[model samples]
Target: MREVFWQLVRFGITGGLATLLYAIVYWPIATYAQKTWPLANSATWPVAANLLGYLAAMLSGYVMHSKWSFRGHGRRDNLARTGGRFFLVSLVSLGMNTFFVWLLTGPMHGPTWWPLVPIVFFTPLITFGLNRLWVFA
Candidate 1:
């Protein structure tokens, strides 16, 4: 019980950091990509920005979750298996974030910040479950 509590705490801290990182990368790109890059289309900038942010968050999340958040909680002998599962879990997060972004920015014609609500609040919870139960288990 106590171990689980600490694990959750650590996971929250790491996940929060990753989420912040994602927002940092996401906001600027989503907001300015169209102006900075000639090829950056307004309609597609959200996707590109989200992808870049997800990549940054995913890489950092994997390391922090593996080394600290889930330390001593699962088998680490097989790097390939564990790493692959982590990547899969991250893809799930990415898909969720992308869908939310599309729903808001595409059809709803909402601002880029609108998708951050779900991406920051909802997606992390799902990814945390997958990472805890499957990737690190």
Candidate 2:
């Protein structure tokens, strides 16, 4: 319904903001660490960078989602429940992202169009439902 649409819009906005934050803050750090550390190989570097970026975004997103996206939802008032639910959602999202990135890089041979394609495509659909019905409700 209308509420669902609004929720989706809100999630989209929140996701955009979180992605911006991740790209702005995490990208340089990831790239620098990758070059400076010399621990991971070229193939492993993207995955490691992505993991760091995802973690940073998730931390920022949890706060933004609680305060902005799901503000009216009383579930966010309960810090533990809200945080736990967010964590659960994030875990699923992380798994999905990892799988997609692995498939793209490993099997698909690195299209390099947008490394965040999986997140951009999948997270909104799945997370919006979870946030509305489970976390926010």
Measured by TM-score, the strongest candidate is: 1
What is the Cα root-mean-square deviation between model 2 and the actual structure? 2.5
lDDT, each prediction: 0.92, 0.72
lDDT of 1 at 51: 98
The parts of candidate 2 lying over 4 Å away from their true place are 24-39, 111-113
User: lDDT tens string, model 2, 27-85?
Assistant: 46544655786776655655666677678889988988887787666554577887888
Question: Candidate 1 on 1-137: residue-level lDDT in tens?
Answer: 89878988999999999999999999998888889886757989999899999999999988999999999998999999999999999999999999998999999999999999998789878887888889999
Query: Where does candidate 1 clash, by residue pair?
Result: none
Model 2 whole-model lDDT (C-alpha atoms) = 0.72
Instruction: Return the TM-score for candidate 2, rounded to 2 decimals.
Output: 0.82
The C-alpha stretches of model 1 lying farther than 4 A from their native spots are none
